[model samples]
Target: MARTYHVYIMSNRHRTVLYIGVTGNLAHRVHAHQDGTGSAFTRRYNVTDLIYAEPYADVDEALRREKQLKRWTRAKKLGLIRRQNPTLQTIQGPYG
Candidate 1:
C-alpha cells in the first residue's frame, strides 16, 4: 500500500499557541503530542488540540505545506483552520 503524509495544526486549550507538523501516522503523532512526547516545542507549550489537517501523496508536499503554514501569521493560520472548524474545537475520532 502507498503511504500517505499529513500536515496538521494543533493548539493549546487556551488557543494561545499553534503547532504545525508533518507525519505519516497522524493519529500516533497527535497522540504523542497529547501525552507530552511529541517535541520540545509542543511539550513546552502544551499544544495538543488537533484542529486542522490535510493529506498529501508525497512526503515532500506535506513537508512543504507544513513549512508554509509555520511561516504564516497567527491570524492567517486561524483563518485557514476556521474554514473547516469555525469554533476551533478539538476534532474528535480518526483524522487519519
Candidate 2:
C-alpha cells in the first residue's frame, strides 16, 4: 500500500490547546500521542485529543495546510475546528 500523508490538529479537553502537525502515517502518529510520545507541547499540555485532520496527496500540500493552520488566529482556528468537528470530539482513532 502507498503511504498517505495528513495535516492534523490536536486539542485539549476544553479545546484550548491546539496543535498542528503533518504525518505520513496518521494512525501511528495519533497512537504516539495517545501513548504519550508525540510532542512536548502535547505531553505537557495534555493535548492528545485529535480534533481535526486533512489528508493530502503529498507532503508539500500537507505542509502547506499545516503552516496555514498554524498562522490562523485562535478564534479562526476554533471556527475551522468547529466546522469540521461540531461537537469538539476526538476523531476516535486515526484513519487513512
Give the TM-score of each candidate.
0.96, 0.92
* TM-score attained by model 2: 0.92
Query: For all the candidates, what are their Cα RMSDs to the real structure?
Result: 0.8, 1.2
Strongest candidate by TM-score: 1
lDDT of each: 0.93, 0.87
Residue range 1-96, candidate 2, lDDT tens digits: 666789999888887788899999888998888778998888888888888888888888889889988999999998888899998899986387
User: What is the number of residue pairs that collide in model 1?
Assistant: 0
Candidate 1, residue 77: how far the Cα is off, in Å = 0.4
The candidate 1 region of ten consecutive residues with least summed lDDT is 87-96
How does residue 86 of candidate 1 score in lDDT? Answer: 99
